[model samples]
Target: MPIQQKDPSRASTYSWPGVLAIALGALSLVVTEFLPVGLLPGICRDLGVAEGTAGLAVTATAILGFIAAPVTAIAIGRADRKRVLLGLTALLIISSVLSWKAESFATLLIARVILGIGVGGFWAISITAAAKLVPPEKVHAASSIVFAGISIGSVIAVPAGSYIGAHADWRDGFMGASVLAVVCFALQLVFLPSLKMKHGVNVRDFFGLLKDPKVRAIFLTVIFIVAGQYAGYTFVTPYLEQITHLSTAIVSVLLFAYGVATVVGNFVGGAFAGRNLHNTVVATVWIFVLSLASIAAFATSPMFAGLSLLVWAVSWGMAPVGTQLWLYNATLHAPEAAQAMNTSVFQLSIGLGSLAGGIAVNHAGLHSSMWLGALILALAVMMVYIVGRMNRQPAVAA
Candidate 1:
């Protein structure tokens, strides 16, 4: 049986399959991007580098993605998006293959840089592309499906890689990811329809979107939200070990449980955003703040710490979908640019949050990082409310 093609012009009916294909792409990109985190120790040992130095493999990908997201969106101006997406996924395949065979830190870093290009490009386009495939009312739902990939990747793929590295050779993790990337690439090639770039964002236009008060507000909210998240999350394992007094095995299990909780939160957030975008977003930020406060105040007991982390995972997981909905609705005409800027902000927030946590850990204490994160989340909550009220654009859903 042949798959019936729908006219792109009349994309009034939702395309769940197409939305799902994009979601899978999101899954593959995230899994590949973060895969090295789990294997860093093995990489250091195998390549004769210190743990701190092997950490560059992760930094390299983020730095490149921070630069590449908007650049790729602009460079591929008016190109057929399906082809662009396919080409980007092909880069992932190549990068993964190179990663598997990497003989030195330099080789692995090179592969990571290549993977960054794919990550940046795929994320820049995926949100808007998914929106185009679905009905207007279902856009948030579609975006959630796509962002759910991020949660799933964090929860499942990275840990799975860590597990594989623990049991077998670390290099096997890269090979396994490479195989997964190939399958995802094939799916995009088969399912994504021909989509030409509409009003590709250049430097001038990109800045113009920022000039819009609503867009600016949304970006500011993201900085605080994500920075707060990473500030605490980046050092969570250490906090667990030192403060919660959990063994390494217990910490690993707890982290895995957090990941599962995050996926559930992703969909829950999406559904709420679909119903009440502003309220849902505001609520999520407050929950995040409370979760951080819990850790900061009462992580002395393992059970208390574990429960706090579970709340943190689920609350933070809602953020991507909620924020993406705000962006898509606020920047109705320039979805690509909005998403690109969001992706760039996301990368920067990770760096900022991690740096903040590092400073806190060095000067104050591990628990201080959680306090800092709570403060940031409090600010984000304020901003989310202000922005939610200010942006009176007709709601995507009543």
Candidate 2:
């Protein structure tokens, strides 16, 4: 069934107001989701836990997202997405407040877990709902636009919060996120056009995705791309400082530069993804591999490594999202499930990448880690090719 979209803003040339609203929702999710990563040192000092223990603040949310998103997608079909988004945003408010007051690592972890449920539920349901906010022809654009928010929010918000924590306090990050979540919630309540799914959620719908070849390929691709970049990205500091022998200040500047490059990639990837999602994903994955390999091979070249990191971050930004739109295209019937599943897969990849990076960094030199990443990205690219083959339909050519 095709979607019905009301003409709204210029951004919604193909979408409705709900797509923009969902992007707002995505902004909140990305901030809350990556907040701990930025504030880990502060959280550790405040809670009197080791940084590793404080890191669980992020782990808890990610684990919860993995556990909760799929089921939420199945259970919450065809409901009022505006209500759903508002409810999740309210949960984000509550969770952020809980995180603000948490005194112990365990308490923070509990709060983070609650935060994860809100994020997981929102990601799973919101993108599919955004798709509904646009006409069928414009579904790709709407979905890509919402996903671009995550990339923008992650690269921009996490760093800003980290800067705040460095200057003021870690709790300030949570406080700011709470205020933003409230604003997002209120905006959704006001400006978001109401929408309903084309059909109700069925138990059978979940099982049906299991039989699809495209789902398997997409799942693999997500795990691959995410795990690869995360492996290097999680340990970019060591790569810059130890491998490249750059000073901390210079490394930070380069990292900030890399982030800026990534934001550029997000917009470029979004535009291309709206056209041909599969080809865009494949191209991004390969570029991702080449970028990682270049850094690993030329670690002593700081200028070259910095340039490679820029490309790497940009391409890394592209894959998680570009593939998401690809998954949306593949699982047209269960768009919610596809979106939610991609979140779960990508979240799981974060955990996996971090763990793998830690292990590889400990056992071998940091230089070897990019190879490990490149290996995974290669697999992800392969999955893209295979899935494209699997999902290939007879194209209507001019």
Candidate 3:
């Protein structure tokens, strides 16, 4: 069925409720995506698989999510975004239910594969949908609201899932996720307006976006920053356990601190980006470099390690908001396509970071990963600086 367009005049009015619904949807999807991270041990024991084998569940989602983002943008083809979102939420519901009942490793992996599709499509459209829900001037705030869900979900998922798995069954965590998705879907049904696309996006649009040097720079910066972050973060627990000599309990508390810092940074970053996009991006990248260096430098001091971790978390929290806003501003003509590309790069870079960090740890030791990450982010700082210079120049007449 063709998506019917709502009255064009409605576009002028803000839909704060609708934006909130999308935020909830984001929360649901993210929780579902990462729940496995905390429940992996239980899953491995139950399914008679090794830890590395169980880890494939996460790898599957990331790899599929990377593919799904751009493909989803092309596949939707001018469809009503409201329905597309609804369908994706429904997919989440199905995936979560399947996961809740999954008894075999194969069954659980299959469920996660379904989830990857939902994750990709939802993220690809969410920012654009959130932007459209309000007036142009409030786009930054709306995007921030959506990003808040991600930050909160990341904080909530592991601990919550772990708690549930410890107290009950790991599958119960997925059941809770399903319940969340169901609520999100219902809220979206009640709140989301018809969101017809202005034009259908195609593969060519993604390629055309790559031709812009600014866009390429933005993506390169994303890769460097995100991959670097993961490289260090992927092994942070070990570093704390061995080098810092913190107990598991203390490490958990510090991680919670990092989570809280991340949430605060998201809003702070959004507010700053709203005021001045270019400067915000530059400042955040620089802060990211410094924070990573601090963590590595103070590896032997628990107080300093914890402090640097919070700072690092804050800088990372700010990063997505700043880079995303930069991408949106640079690709106003095709924001969705650009966002889809951003999503792909972000997912791929996570895998890259983890792999690189793993290699660095295996060879050079735990501290090496953090230093490598900082070095990678230095490149990102340079890219952001060059991009800032490009933006400052006057446009030549075509």
Candidate 4:
């Protein structure tokens, strides 16, 4: 069944406060999701686990998030969205506290699983709701703000956690996340509107998206680009140390620069994608592929490596919004379902990319991961072209 069309005159007015709160919530959720990435070594030592085992703290959230997203979307059908978002934020707070108090790896993994539920659900709603929180003209800006939270999370939160955990204790990172979550939760409770469901997604709507070849193509583009990006990026620091001989401080500065570029890329992406999603994705993927290839082929010098990393960050950072908009436009009726599936695939791609990178690092060498990433991303570019050709049918609203 198609979604009913809305009268253009009844469009929402911009609500900066509501949108800002959602962006903050998005930032907090991403920070909580990846908080352990920066503290893996510390977690291993404190919990008496191997580094590989401690890595599960990050994996647990992603795997469960992949499962939780679609389920939460379907289960919470027709429920008040504001209440659901608030409940998810509360879950984040509890998960953070539990992470702080966890004594064993099992305990910590349990907390991450809980956090995954919130992360998945929060993402599922936040992106789809952005259009609702503002006038149609400002939807792109609102969506960009929400995704900027992701870039900022990648840029600041993880590094801050590492610094805090090193200065104090690993648990301190969790404590900080808990405090931030509390603040975000309170703000949402006070300011977020009562966003009741206009239409509920059913099992059919969820499955219906896969029936579209274009949607499948979009998902494939996401998987290949994201997985390839992470495959190389997971071991980037090691590559910098081994290949470029960069010191820890230089590496930190380079990473910080990369983060900043990503934020810039987010806004640029919004503009580009808003004007032309196909061209934005096509251009971004090539930039991503070329950057990785540059690092693989010519990163013998620190300057070259740093420059490649910066370009990669900007291209990849611009990706989420462009990709989200592509999927939303591609499946107008099933936007939530599209977003949910995209979220799940995004999480899965991270895990896949990391796993692939780990294997490459073990068998080939650290530098080899860059080559692997480039190869997969080239395939992604091809996928994008193929999808473009197949999208001759006009997009239909659900």
Compare the candidates by TM-score and give the number of the best one. 4
Off by over 4 Å in 4: 1-15, 44-54, 130-141, 165-168, 238-243, 271-279, 297-300, 362-368, 392-398
Q: How close is candidate 1 to the true structure, as a TM-score?
A: 0.81
Per-residue alpha-carbon lDDT of candidate 2 for residues 314-384, written as tens digits (9 for 90 to 100): 89767656776667676888765566667778777776775676567667867767888888888887888
lDDT of 3 at 199: 74
Superposing all C-alpha atoms, what RMSD in Å does each candidate have to the true structure? 5.0, 5.0, 4.6, 4.6
Give one clash count per candidate, in the order shown: 0, 0, 0, 3
Put the candidates in TM-score order, highest first: 4, 3, 1, 2
Best by lDDT: 3
Residue lDDT tens for model 1, 217-281: 88889989988987777566557767888765676677788889888888899799889887898
Better of 3 and 4 by lDDT: 3
Ranking by lDDT: 3, 4, 1, 2
lDDT of 1: 0.79
Model 4 clash number: 3
In angstroms, give how far residue 387 of model 3 lies from its true place: 2.2
Angstrom error at residue 161, model 3? 4.2
Instruction: Output the TM-score of candidate 4.
Output: 0.85
lDDT of prediction 3: 0.82
Error of 3 at 126 (Å): 2.0
Candidate lDDT (C-alpha), each: 0.79, 0.74, 0.82, 0.79
Report the error of model 1 at residue 95, Å.
2.8
TM-scores, one per candidate: 0.81, 0.80, 0.82, 0.85
Ten residues in sequence with the least summed lDDT for candidate 1: 6-15
TM-score of 2: 0.80
